[model samples]
Target: MGVIPFLLTYDIIIKFIEKSSIGINYLLIMSGGIILSLFLKGYLYFQGLNASHEAAFDTLMGMRIKFVEKMRKAPLGEINAKGVGSYKKNLIDDIDSVETLLAHMIPEGIPFVIVPILIYTMIFVTDWRLGLLSLGSIPFGFIPMMFMMKNGTKKMPMYYKSAEDMNNTIIEYINGMEVIKIFGRTTDSYKRYKDSVEGYRDFTLDWFRESWTYMAMYTAVLPCTILLLLPVELNVYLNGTLELSKFIFSLMLSMSAGVPLTRMLDFAPTVIQLTYKIDQLEKTFEGVQLKEGNESIAIKKHTIEFKNVTFAYEEEDVIKDVSFKLRQNTLTAIVGESGSGKSTLAKLLVHFWDIQKGEITLDGKNINKFSVTDLMNEISYVSQDNFLFNTSIMENIKIGNPKATEEEIKEAAKLAQCHDFIVEMEEGYNTIVGDSGDKLSGGQKQRITIARAILKNSPIIIMDEATAFTDPENEDKIQAALSKLIVGKTVLVIAHRLSTIVDADNIIVMDNGELIAQGTHKELLEKNHKYKTLWESHMKSMDWGIQVEEEEYA
Candidate 1:
């Protein structure tokens, strides 16, 4: 279908002397060729574009969802290693690079490679002289750019890292702009951001300049190919080495070879960068992802056991050979100074970090087998650094249970001691929180997070200093509400404030990542160790004149 029309048009057009005095037979064949070629090429072009678009869209969306799911399921140790700035860079800039490759660069380059081989092959059969010259031009056009493209690929990772640094600097500057102004420290740090922007600009423009300069030379090189073949073509014509029709076909073929060849060089940097970006995204996606299914966490029973569990972050052990157990429905408190691994212990029970050499079990089954999605369905966590999305107050509370009824949300808010203040707002439940709930005070934000947990009403509750920022009245109210919330669930409390968990059924004291003491509040005081010192400090900080007397062991 293609060959007959190409030859017919080539011969017919070459023979037609004047556009004014059109050859009827030649005109019909030429019109048919134009129509047929246009339709075929247009169809192929649209098909290729659509395929690339679909593929790029899937990879882009998949990377986003995969990274989010990985973060939710990965060990906190692994997840935290990838900081906010790096992850942000991957999501925004890195993904954009991949999209360019998938969409424009790759799809377009396919034609660059395919059409050249084909057009050159046809010219070779007609006249070998023009064919050899055309083949030689391919290497000349591509070889010089090969080293630069290789270097560009090597530079890509650092370029992305540098770009991310600029991104982070800008984000940091904006986030700290108010503080910088208040402290009058803007000049020093903001200048650094200005420099980073310039650096990125210079790097980018240099890359473009190098690519375009070489590319223009490569394109300009193609016309010289015609001149190189000129002598050979003339000799062939004079000695009956090439016929008039063959000469015409060779001319068209040489002209056609130039385009896809120059394009391959012009597109080289994009292709290289795209390949690199996709590889990076794949690395990001290769981590674990949380899944929802029947086989989630182990079934809850009347008791929970921690059998000599040990855990580490990188090389440093955060929790060491820790062993403890709690009867069902009891509040187990882990109390320690900051950095003593209290929070790490809380995370272990929730299966955030699987034990290295020990076992955590409910009903004598290892918890690691269960999916995080399943475990989260039964566990509610309120950390000291509570995070809330920018949304209506009602919706933030509803995060605990997306389908929670309005009444249920309000009741949860009431239980968390936030209902009164929420009602005072002009929009009440409809009030919109700014990013990370920044519009609210620490106490209010904590209460909102608490309300979210309450709305969840999971069977296992983990409170990691949940009241660290609540005011006195709100603290008392939240404590009272938490008392009710913990009634039937297994509760784990991680606190730096000893008083908060003074009434806990069990208090395990940690120091230097080791469990140094364990017992009820009364028992730990007589032990006269870290727990006693912590308790005494808590009492003194309150300015209490005397310690409350307890029943004597004597």
Candidate 2:
């Protein structure tokens, strides 16, 4: 950026000397030197831009990726309220708009600014009258440009908003395509897509119309400078108001000044657009917040604790003043009906939302203090909605422990009761699960998810609705595997299959987001109406009405 202008200046100086006849060889020699230097500078600039472009792309991409990674470890309620589509739009599409500003407007535009300053300086010494004429004409061209900016400014926000809507529409359309297809609502997506595109198109046309309207007045009709300069030059030539050479030089230099001023005018819209784009990026980047220690790479020892916690969402009190201790090495089952905050309770334990009136600690330290990654590492979570990547069964299992050996992966699969079924498939563990594990049934997906958690080997295990949908046959096998997994671990289970955790060391019962009862299954049944009813329900569901069996809840 700094080199190109000086080369141009040197070339101009050679031409000036040739006009002055400062040794004819001087023109040839200096001109050749300037040409060669310009070629070298051009080559170097192109090469530098190539390398810079590569670096810029990587840096920008990493910035976006890291931004997302940061947000993933934040409060789920906040992230959801903001909408994933909007976040993606900000992270990718909005950021893409800044690329031109950074790569072109910043680096290349520096020289444009400097070259004008050099022109003004040279013209000032050569002829103050022409310099004044040059300077005066530059500002006159801006009258039309100022009006152009005023109109374009009004439409800038509309254009950007239209782009954002397009991004949001694409996300929603893709995500809901199946529903759209099932309901035969295909035109919804097309309409949304078309509307967003049309908005951008209309706004862009308006912007161009404003520019060209002003452009026609400024360029086609000749700027005030030409009308103004013509009189000054003719008066000087006819009346001998100045030296012929000086008058001649002034005319040529005045014309040269037009190109830069015109260029500066051409760049006016870019400057405006780039400014707005940068502001948009800054707004998004600043609005997103992060928890402390979230950037640390080390995992710390911590225990999950809920202390007099009260959590609510908008107007719904999902957890009301509930207090419990999740022991360091005990299996704790939290059994409750739907809307009893079973899954919500699990979310609390993982610090997905901060309790409104209570504190959650890990190893006696606040969960907020630990870096997000560190906190996640302390607990292996199996959400009610179990998800798997579209990859090999082995790869999905290995996600929990990236460096785990094949043997270790197989061991986790066996423990989760997934190994046998996986091996039955032709490709075995190598079989692709398809998108979100669609190739597998719900039960198969659940088992693989369990395998993933088992492989994580976190000190704390949270299994929310862990065994709810498994068939009786697979349920038994999964229960057997889970029995081994929960032993000597701080385990929190949210289960609807009440029989599976009948002997849990502790059972917590929640109703309307409040802890109604908590105790051993036998103790709870003896003391609480809710527990007794739930126990009776479980017994009837098993169809063991008259069968003799060991009564753990007796």
Please give the RMSD to the true structure for each candidate, in Å.
6.2, 6.6
For each candidate in turn, the TM-score is 0.89, 0.84
Candidate 2, residue 97: lDDT: 61
TM-score of candidate 1 relative to the true fold: 0.89
The segments of candidate 1 whose C-alpha lies over 4 angstroms from its true place after superposition are: 1-9, 17-22, 39-44, 105-107, 205-212, 223-225, 287-294, 544-554
Candidate 1 lDDT, 165-210, residue by residue in tens: 7887888888888799999998898898899999989988887677
How well does model 2 score by local distance difference test?
A: 0.76
Q: Which lDDT values do the candidates have, in the order given?
A: 0.79, 0.76
Query: Which one wins on TM-score?
Result: 1
